[model samples]
Target: MKSNFRHIGLAKLCGWFGISRQAYYQYNWETISSTLEEEMVLMQVRDIRSRHRRMGTRKLYEILHPFLLENQIKIGRDGLFDLLSANHLLVRRRKRRIQTTNSYHRLRKYPNLIREMIPTAINQIWVSDITYWKLGEIHLYISFITDVYSHKIVGYHVG
Candidate 1:
């Protein structure tokens, strides 16, 4: 691969780079070996995805962790993500609404009296929101409570 870099032979290129020709060949071999490793990992991922189509990268790394350890493959979660992205194997994420608020309920809707009012004390007003995080083929729902004045997360729970 280095030969086509220019009209010059790899030997001359190696000389110009001030490195041995063996080093150049070794570098190419290492690149090939690394590419092969990634390809192997991709194969395993495809096999896993056949059964679990919507798996996300984090869980993929967790499942592959044992296999990678057993096979002497050194790859991190981000590296695997990059590889999956390069191969167009990465799963696309979709947002889902959990209907945290039911507008059609019989209870009266409360008006925002404090909409423009700033909280004077930490406990004067507390705001709560629901956050959704995608995990593999599942979605994790977390609710958090924050003190309006302090802007601090006082409590959180995952459902």
Candidate 2:
């Protein structure tokens, strides 16, 4: 590629590509500058993470504002996100789901009998569910049986 460019000349090649030689050089310089900026940002991010391991991008960007201004670096929130994502430096969110049932218990497992059942009339099928309501510091368990066809609560118990 270097030999081809030397034989054909860069200005003619740039003209063939519908761009001026200066524009081509400018593009190359922009790439180099962007790479240097990203490297600097990564170093700052690592330094911050060393102090706060679970720091997220938004907080990091906020903390990095002064450093960025001092270093004359310009990067937006989404640009920082992209840089962290590409380099695998982004922090992952923990799953918030609370496990309410243990399916792997040693007790005998019962098959779901209502899998294919569709209620054609009222009282033909009833479905039951248990849920909890938070009352101040206590969780009150509420169990209810509902008529499938009418979509009404037939019976309920709070404990």
Alpha-carbon lDDT, every model:
0.90, 0.93
For all predictions, the C-alpha RMSD in Å is 8.4, 5.6
Tell me the TM-score of each prediction against the true structure: 0.57, 0.62
Stretches > 4 Å off in candidate 1: 1-9, 98-159
Q: Which residue pairs in model 2 clash with each other?
A: none
lDDT of 1: 0.90
Distance from true location, Cα of 95 in model 2, Å = 0.8
Per-residue CA lDDT of model 2 for 42-92, tens digit only, reads 999999999999999999999999999999999999999999999999999
- Model 2, 73: alpha-carbon shift in Å? 1.2
Q: Pick the candidate with the highest lDDT.
A: 2
Report the Cα lDDT for residue 120, model 2: 90
RMSD of 2: 5.6
Per-residue lDDT for 114 in model 1?
Answer: 74
